[model samples]
Target: MAMDTPFDEFLKEWSDNIDKVRTGAGLLSKIRDADVDVGTTPKTLIERRDKVELFRYDPIAERSVDTPVLIVYGLIGRYTMADLQPDRSLVRSLLAKGIDLWLIDWGQPGRGERWLTIDDYVDDYIDEAVERICAETGHEKITLLGICEGGVFTTCYAALHPRRVKNLVLTITPIDFHADVDDPALHRGFLNVWIRSLEASDIDLMVDALGVIPGEFMSSVFSLMTPMRSIAKYNVDLIDTVDDRDKLMNFLRMEKWLADRPDHPGSAGRQWLHDLYQENKLIKGEFALSGRKVDLGAVKMPILNVFALDDHIVPPNCSKALGQKAGSKDYTEIPLPGGHVGLFVSSRSQGGLTKNIADWLTARDG
Candidate 1:
């Protein structure tokens, strides 16, 4: 209970420095040796179209759900997130729960894809994928499981062609983009406000000049949303996990996923930032694709809206707005604890999220 002497304090400082050096060396060794390859769950490529590829996962369990679920990930990031690792994979988790799973990979859009608009994605790419899944499964209707921006695509597709979708599942998606104003919390919805602050011409200029929005550019913008955490992750946060291989591997895997963001097509990028983010078109029932308006009321299929309680990119309110606007009499909203990506990767939410989705789809499979 007495205060430490100068010698004792010096010894403590020296010991701490030694521990830091050892931890740093261990981290470096792991970084050099660790297999950080993501989206590793075994899957087969079933179809391909230009930059998009559709994959069907080999079943790991007896199929309980008659309808197949097609996961649609936005161009901003790769679908590898859903299967970041065997232990924390949403894809594997759902598969283990006896769900037939498929995913659409919007493979790394390049300069050549600059002219591709959202219409091309929703009406062409997603529609073609859905049709292919249907034909393969021999099911008249397949479930659409869309994540983030992909959720908007599925929503549009569902609203436009309700009969094609048996069920609609959206995770960490934004419906009412401007709904962020309701909370105005510093750590949440910064992306929405930032996009809204820009002029339409600003969006146009950026898209026109770049041809395609660079993945690094969007990653930087996302980092800006939580500037402090983004910086600390490499130093303070990483050091805490250096001594634990499992924990350190998880961190490295997540970093691997983040580093693999794909460029978004220019026209689609423009519509996303300008029409949706700036104009707040989707919820207003004004967002259109292929010359047809996307009316939320047209989303009459059973809807499962899973939102993160602490989502910084897409605020909870923005996602929750779907429950009220969707035409489905059977609308469900799940508010899970985590930020945007954590909803899929965090161990705390993975079990419940997958179970909820599996159960929801199972209930409606008949």
Candidate 2:
């Protein structure tokens, strides 16, 4: 056995520094010319209403499931995350499995849409989209696949119109908002605690004054949940990924997605922060839309609840709570290893996540 001399150690350090500099320079050059545009999978615009547009992905493989799946993403972020890139796309993965896919794009909402509320989104937009999908496919019902906040929208929809949804799939969705209190870990449910700390009047005042909640403001709040990581992402993490082309591309694509946050409408934002986050209305069966109470017990359709094991934004307990509350007899909860966004984009989760969804829907396609 031998040990390195001081001179040898110094030479090794010098070589490492040179490699770092070379990698950093190459990263900067790639940033200057990198094509980081996302959501490139081919799809057709099927319908449009106000700022909401519904798209149906062009089939890449033979259809196996008779019922189509409608993906609904929340207003805070675009649906681009689902189809970020060809290699790391949830949309493409499901499509490759012969599943018919459709998605609802809640377009960039400005002051004009500030009047919209949860009722308009669930009752009007989602309902209409479901109807359109059913009519187009000549099927009586279609699957509702919701992501994050969009999962709540779909859950509300399925509860309100059970017969319209053949199956419900929720990923990184929070059913019991206050379930984070059970864990009480600092990394988990910071959003819930922050929102609960504010008064209802505070939410009203902000929405009334701003008309729409700025996307950047929400993004900053999310950053506060994992402050250290947010800081390191641009510095240490970026440097670490620079040496690998695929990893660097993934990093840039994520940065591009993070930068494209959309402003949330005032009324809906108010209900979300106050009614759901603060009051815990949805889990309590008190959340209502269009003068109708949203009862989780009314969610009679088969449900596949997918939660991330290490999700900090929406805690595992919060999502797992759905298994006990939902009205479905065949409810299944699958916990994957990753954060909220990683459930959709991480290579580790890509296989299990897609297979679980495709397989679940296929079995229930009766």
Candidate 3:
């Protein structure tokens, strides 16, 4: 083929630019029309109180489980992201797979509850919720699926009651926060340099005023870790998929989840940063919550460590390393190709993470 003239090249470039602009405009239109689903799986809020709310996801077809699975979400985002939409929800997929679900919804905390700690959130709230689940399900043991920071809580829960947790699953969890001190993803060593000043400045005051950690603040932190990717990558993609409704809905649902900020209780937020991130206490087994020391070695339940290859928040090493430290004979790790958030939303991971979860649970009826 003969090479095109410079004028022809200029025309092609102009046409591509126009297409991008049109695509972006169409995307914004669809985004505004779509119904954002920040609500979680089909469940009713059975329990609600200050800084804590519990939900029950009714089994799709009469649950056959001798044990119920409770999903613990991270402090960063709302729980419903797992069940973003009916079609693309992790909770919905689990329901279809016959895994009875229970979710912990820590609704926006109030000023009165601003002093809550990880100890309070995990021990007073989560521990009580676990008991409630046991009473409701009539099962002495329950399966735990903890994602991100929630996994840290679940680890403590399992350690406290080794026999109570039949099977334990940790997804995109950062047990070894100190893994890569120099790696920007974990922010283990370097983050501390800024935390003291940030906490002493407007950021701390901002949380104090709001009573919980703001989603916007957390999002900004995530952005700083990967400035170009978080800031520019999405806008560029938005311009290319304006007319694709399904793609647009996916984008909007995610954007909604991203914006639906959850404020972290001040006390809990401070302890988390100081103890876990700054001191790296979890991996060293020096962490204590609820007046008792937490040891990962005590987590002897059958463990499944699921991690995403591209997870910037909780790197693969952070999650995959759980299996080795838990000292569980039946420990397993499932590595999928996606990021921290993508693990819940990515199409490719849906089949693998979803099916594997059911099979893994059913296979181990401890």
Per-candidate RMSD, Å? 2.0, 2.0, 3.3
Q: Alpha-carbon error at 340 in model 3, in Å? A: 0.9
TM-score list, all predictions:
0.95, 0.95, 0.88
Model 3, span 1-366: residue lDDT tens: 343898888888778878877876865665443365556456888787666788888778655455789999977678877888877789988888778889998876656677788888777788888888898878888999998889888988899777678889888888877664445554332334455335444656665678767667777876787677776757677665655767777778887887777777777887777777767788888998876888889988889889888776676766666766786888988999887788988888877898888888988864
Query: Which residue pairs show collisions in model 2?
Result: none
Spell out the clash pairs found in candidate 1.
Answer: none
> Which of 2 and 3 is ahead in lDDT?
2
Off by over 4 Å in 1: 1-14, 23-27, 30-34
What ranking of all candidate models by TM-score puts the best one first? 1, 2, 3
Prediction 1 TM-score vs. true: 0.95
lDDT of 1: 0.90
Ranking by lDDT: 2, 1, 3
How much is 117 displaced in model 1, in angstroms?
A: 0.5
Which regions of candidate 2 fall more than 4 Å away from where they truly are?
A: 1-11, 30-34
Candidate 3 local lDDT, residue 180:
48
Q: Write the per-residue lDDT of candidate 1 for residues 1-366, one digit (tens) a residue.
A: 353798888888678767975986776675663477788899999998897899999999999997999999888899999999999999999999899999998888899999999999999999999999889989999999999999999999999988899999999999999898987576788888888888888778888899998999999999888889999998778777766777878888899899899889999999999889999999999998999999999899999999999888898999999988888999999999988999999889989999999989988888
Q: Which lDDT tens digits does candidate 2 get at residues 1-366?
A: 243798888888678767976886786686653488699999999999998999999999999887999999998898999888998899999999999999999899999999999999999999999999999989999999999999999999999999899899999998899999989567888888898999888888889999999999999999888889999998788767777777888898998899899999999999999889998999999998999999999898899999999899899999988888888998998999999999888999988999999999999986
* Weakest ten-residue segment in model 2 by summed lDDT: 25-34
